[model samples]
Target: MWPDTTKVVLRQGPEVHIRPMVAADAEALHRFFLALPEEDRLFLEDDVTKPAFVQQLLAEQEAGRAFPVVAEASGEIVGYGVLYRPLFGWSTHVGRVRMAVARSFQRQGLGTAILRELVRKAQGLALDKLVAEVVEDQVGALRAFERLGFHREATLGNHVQDLSGKKRDLVLLANDVAHIWEHMEALVADFEPSAG
Candidate 1:
């Protein structure tokens, strides 16, 4: 089972609460997606702006295949840590990660905060590997993944097209659990509630 709730201090120095996605958060998640920039939305596999995709995501979460969580600052949803694991597929042992942060919050350590939580969850699930794909133009996003030990594994040129009809390469990054876990353990420890 996923952990209850935790608060993280962003790299830019603000505390925000994060917790696993629940069915009731559908509306908030939808609003969060609609608030993101067009460039960020263009590369998503699903049109989250539509109610259908959000429903599908909720269904997937209900079935235990998806484990998405939202980060909230004050009273608004600011980001999410999207994680998934296939139940019976060939890649069942692998965890897939997708991160989204509010535009104003990007590059301020929110992405890293969300990712650290996801990595800790993956480790608990005993996953063998974690993977994330970033569009070539999203240099900051790629760097955020790298900060957590994700290394480039593959790059597919012209693999996806953006809204401008321009093709973008997909940068595939992977982190082997064993090698990255030691580094992430310290972070997991930091987020734990104090024993006081």
Candidate 2:
């Protein structure tokens, strides 16, 4: 389902290459996470800076339980996104997506590009819906997901704790795969230059 690589131009002008994560990326992935600020890492489910965590992610990909996409610019990883789904279970039709973009690339469409890749993968996998969890404090992330057609399905009060030990509400956002694809097409049309 993955091509060799593809390049995407950010809304703000930088170009990034998107590709599937490989085993050789373990060290680079570790470095990418380590570069993120501690505050940015707070919402992450795992300690991504650890090499073991990177290996685990690779293992999940190898085991076919996860699909990871990497975005690179200037030979460095600038964004990462993953789609995780159960192989067998009642929830097998649903995929959970997580994404992170480097601070320098935020707000420039890198996050959206990475997400677009994951959404495409989800469609290819025949997933019916995609869900994302965000802390209440992540207003930007919430808005971004909403723009992509996700709606808040539920909010779990004090469901997650930050690295600082502060409890925060966890907002569950979800959308059907078909609806998300429709919204994405609309976004593309809105951004395309008019031929006049």
Candidate 3:
């Protein structure tokens, strides 16, 4: 089981609370998505701003199909990360990760911190590998994942379309969970809980 909630200090010197998203978070999660820029929402698989979409996400969590974590600051959701695992399939040992951070909070290590929490969850679940799909133009996301030890496994041509119906190449990055754990352990400094 994940912890009830924890706090981490970002590189920018602000602290954010991280916790597993609960069913009651549907409304706030929707608001968070609605606040995202169109460019940021373009590559998302689903229309997260829709209340129905948020409800579906909560249902997925209830059914154990998805595990989502959220970061809150000043009582508002600013970051989100989720792990998608197949319960029964040829690749049950693999989990797909997706993350998003508020535009105002970008470049402050919040994305990395959220990903770290998901990685810990993946480790606890004994997932062998974690994979992330990124559009070619999402350079920041690509770099963030790369910094965490993810390597390009494949790049599919025009595999996804943007909000404007523009087809874009999709890059798949994957890393062994154990390898990621080792990298995290070897990080120059760990983000420990903030002292109140």
| Model 3 ranges off by over 4 Å | 188-196
Query: CA lDDT of each candidate?
Result: 0.81, 0.86, 0.86
Alpha carbon deviation, residue 18, candidate 2 (Å):
0.7
Q: Identify the runs in model 2 with alpha carbons over 4 angstroms from their true place.
A: 192-196
* CA RMSD per model (angstroms): 2.8, 2.6, 1.8
List model 2 lDDT by residue over 29-116, tens digit each.
8899999987778888888888998788888998999999899899899899999999998999999999999999998777777787
Superpose all Cα atoms of candidate 3 onto the true structure and report the RMSD in Å to 1 decimal. Answer: 1.8
Candidates ranked, most accurate by TM-score first: 2, 3, 1
Quote each prediction's TM-score: 0.89, 0.94, 0.94
Off by over 4 Å in 1: 185-196
